[model samples]
Target: MKKIGIIGGMSWQSTQTYYKAINEGVNDHLGGLHSAELLMYSVDFAPIEQLQHNHQWPQLANKLSHAAQSLERAGADCIVIATNTMHKVADVMQENISIPIIHIADAVAVKLKQKGIDTVGLLGTAFTMEQDFYRQRLQDKHGIKVLIPDAPHRTCIHEVIYKELCHGHVYPDSHLAFMRIINELHFSGAQGIILGCTEIGLLVSQSDTDIALFDTTFIHAQAAVEFALS
Candidate 1:
């Protein structure tokens, strides 16, 4: 198997999920005693979060590029950025590394297309929700339609992601709030909901709702396994 490189710890909680899911995927594919062959450069999220909040994307991109270069030099075959929001700088990260960085949005788009979803709801950091990097890729590159919650709901989801989910805090009230937003998205003609934020899967899942829920953390991990095992 190829050695998968991960630039993680945008928030360690979701990074943990990526690590676990990728290993589980490999083990499930190869059976007993098999796990993913991987290397991870876990960054400190505090500075990264602060940069994001300040809209210091160029600085953030440099940081991510450094992490990807570290993984490449250490013998990782490909890279995975562990968070959705940070993918805004993915281009800079990719430019710095020779090995490919498996994009979370592309993985998600493939799954959505397979399910024949034409329109999907997105939930992530305010940057991801309001930015063009992610949604434009889905729409322009993959012919998918993207929908997001209204401004107030977008703010609520953003706060839940950083303040609550990133810190490993899950509350019933927060889940309820997410559910309400999901329902509204469904009513707004979303064929599915993309848990664009990696941490979101911690609070909600397919079992929590009838609308198709695409969790990028797991989907991206699964895609990494496919790349590694191929």
Candidate 2:
């Protein structure tokens, strides 16, 4: 199997999910005792989060680019940024390193197209939602229409991700709030919802809504396994 390099620990909470899901996917595919061949360079989220909130993306890009270089030097076949929001620097990371950065948005987009989902409501960090890096990739590359919550609801979703989910806290009120946003997106002509943040799947699932929900964490992890094995 090809080695999968993970750029992780943006929170460590959802990085744990990526590790689990990727290993589980590999095991399910290959059976007993088989698991993923992976390398991880986990970062401290405090500094990263500070950079994100401060809009210091150039520094963040440099930091992650160095991480990708380290993984490549250590023989990782390809890199996966474990967080969705960090993918804003994916191109930078790829340019600075030899191995491919298996993108979360592209992985999600493939599934979206396969499922014939034309329009999707996106829930993520404010940067991922408001910024063009992610939404534009979907719309321009895959012809998928992207919708995000309004300013207020976007704030609530962003807060829940950073304040609660990143800390491994899941609250009922937060769950209710997300559900309401998903419903609103559905009524607003969203064919499905993209749980664009990795930590979001911890609070909500397809079981919680009839509207199709795309959990990017698992989708990206599964894509990593496919890339590794192929």
The C-alpha TM-scores of every prediction are: 0.99, 0.99
Query: Mind sharing the TM-score for model 1?
Result: 0.99
Off by over 4 Å in 1: none
Q: Report the CA-based lDDT of candidate 1 relative to the real structure.
A: 0.94
| Cα lDDT of model 1 by residue, 19-69, tens digit | 999999999999999999999999999998999999999999999999899
Candidate 2 ranges beyond 4 A from true positions? none
Clashing pairs in 1: none
lDDT, candidate 2, at 168? 96
